[model samples]
Target: MNKLPPDPAPATRLDRSQRSGPTIRDVARAAGVSIGTVSKALNNAGTLKQETRERVAEAARALGFRPNDLAQALHRGQSFTVGLISNDSFGRFTMPILEGLESVLHDERIAVFMCNATDDPEREREHLEQLMGKRVDGLVFTARRADRRPSVGVNLGDLPTVFVFSQSDDPRSFCLLPDDEGGAYLGARHLVATGGRRIAHVTGPERFEAVRLRRDGYRRALAEAGLDWRDDFFLPGEWSEQWGRQAVDILFSSTAAAPDSILAGNDQIARGILDALRDRGLNVPGQVGVVGFDNWGVMVEAARPRLTSIDMNLSTLGQEAGRRILRMIGGEHFSGVERLPCTLMVRESCGAQAKTLFQEARST
Candidate 1:
């Protein structure tokens, strides 16, 4: 009945703190402009005057307004996204390669969506299709096996795709690979210079393109030295420590000449070789010299005898892959197969001549 004394004139007051977060509308209001004007100014549309753009930007900064990437991408008809495919396992080798790729891709304001294929053809195909469905602007592949075919569940028509640390003969695909031949040549030459002979090799699958290149490098070095590459000196095996360790046993048990030098497929394999050498009471670089690939820091640093190894520079491979894919997206013509240079890090295992070879390689 009292009517609350006419509602006390409705308490004529505005709640400045009522809004949750800053919005474009709030920015427009603060800048004393219309919503369309604010949008045009923020987007740097030429239709807006410079003074209006400045005022709108100032208002946005004051209100802490930010543009949404997804919305902006939608408006621009671009996803600003890249899809990365790799092996299924979290192998130590792939991490550095991924980091390198990520660093370069992030600089270009591109988002990367990655998946592991687990070396399964079907799973890889499925993930590829999903990424394509999401409209990624580009695609990257890091396969466990060097020989891998690419796919996107579609023709991939004009989509940009690149492979890193792997290879594909598909004429349509771009591949960035380490100079395996060059790296192997450097390692073998280092061993030969360090007064190491009776050189032998413990290697991964020869079917892989990179592996074959490395083998060719080994042969080339031997040929350059006017030495015969004996089939017995080349050991085909898995890229594992067990293979290296067992190789030592095989070499020691047989009357066959023990290699004064050995080239391993990777750091892990090198570690195996070292373990077997130590077990047999042999000193690295003294009784036997060893060289490996994939200059893995953890093993090389903690190596008891300090293993000498060639670095494929997987990170550089990744960065180049990213750059090439970007260029491809920009409609630039590129070599379908790009080879990245690698380096050798000399240490106690293969003896100290590695530094000299590295220097000479750089000069050449």
Candidate 2:
């Protein structure tokens, strides 16, 4: 074997300074703070005065010094990153939450790692272990609905965690859920305010916790307006536009008087109801008012009179979750369930002109 041409002279290398960035020590000097303080400020751990942390951050930004020593940071049990695990494969709900969460964490220089568990137990367990191995700073769990589900099987051992669109069984666990009952109430009450009596609720399966809550809310709104809820007026079917179209015929045939207003469980059903009503030569908001949940823009915009719907405020929920989780990571404890209020997207479907209606004054 021709002796490897005397191990070809080693290729020339660039000096650390030539390809390097400002060091931690440089940041410390620029901020007039100790290296420990700089690490605390950048790594987001340990005790440091707020003003001093801000100074260190500003100096690091000015010098373009970013701490990239992962091993050293994890050895101290700190990582300036979070892990978000979601079961929503469609991203129909999770995307908005992620957008809000990133907006909050990005400002603090904390990064997030997203994982899709897709309603699989084994996959979720595996993701939990992997996130732990990465030494994430905290965890956020989001589901597609506000139903009670199994707790995280893995023992996170004091790791910060927040749940969204679902409630944990444990009272000590921090949970967030959209106020579905309140949302339905707002929809029905708006119908009443806009002169809709004989209101009928066409909704999804009753097995769903949200469905039952909305049913109760619909009844409550009518009751408050001195209108009794007729058992025949309530229709429960699968969550689909087809069922919505079918229900219209069923209601008209069974009841002596047709419902003047219909509150659909979701935008899909609302669109179907609108289509069927139009076919029957009924003028929306004149012959019948309509409302839907979820405020899904695609279906709402397509429906005649622009389907008035309840907004779950998923983005706001995500932002709030991010803020609270960060606080938990910083030694604050937030336990118990927090039900964020839903918003009403006022539109022509409810006999109201499409207009901006802020939530706080909803009753008006």
lDDT value, residue 297 of candidate 2: 78
Q: How close is candidate 1 to the true structure, as a TM-score?
A: 0.84
lDDT of 1 by residue, 198-312 (tens): 8888888787766787888887888777777988788878888999898888777878777889988888889999999999999888889999888889888788788788887
- What C-alpha lDDT does candidate 2 achieve relative to the native structure? 0.87
Task: At residue 248, give the lDDT of candidate 2.
Answer: 87
Residue 166 lDDT in candidate 1: 66
TM-score against native, each model: 0.84, 0.81
* Model 2 agreement with the true structure over 204-265: per-residue lDDT tens digits: 99989999988988888998999988998899998889988998888777639899999999
332 Cα displacement, candidate 1 (Å): 0.8
- For every candidate in turn, the CA RMSD to the true structure comes to 7.6, 6.2
The runs of at least 3 residues in candidate 2 whose Cα sits more than 4 Å from the true structure, single-residue gaps closed, are 1-69, 360-364
lDDT for 70 (candidate 2): 72
Clashes of each: 1, 0
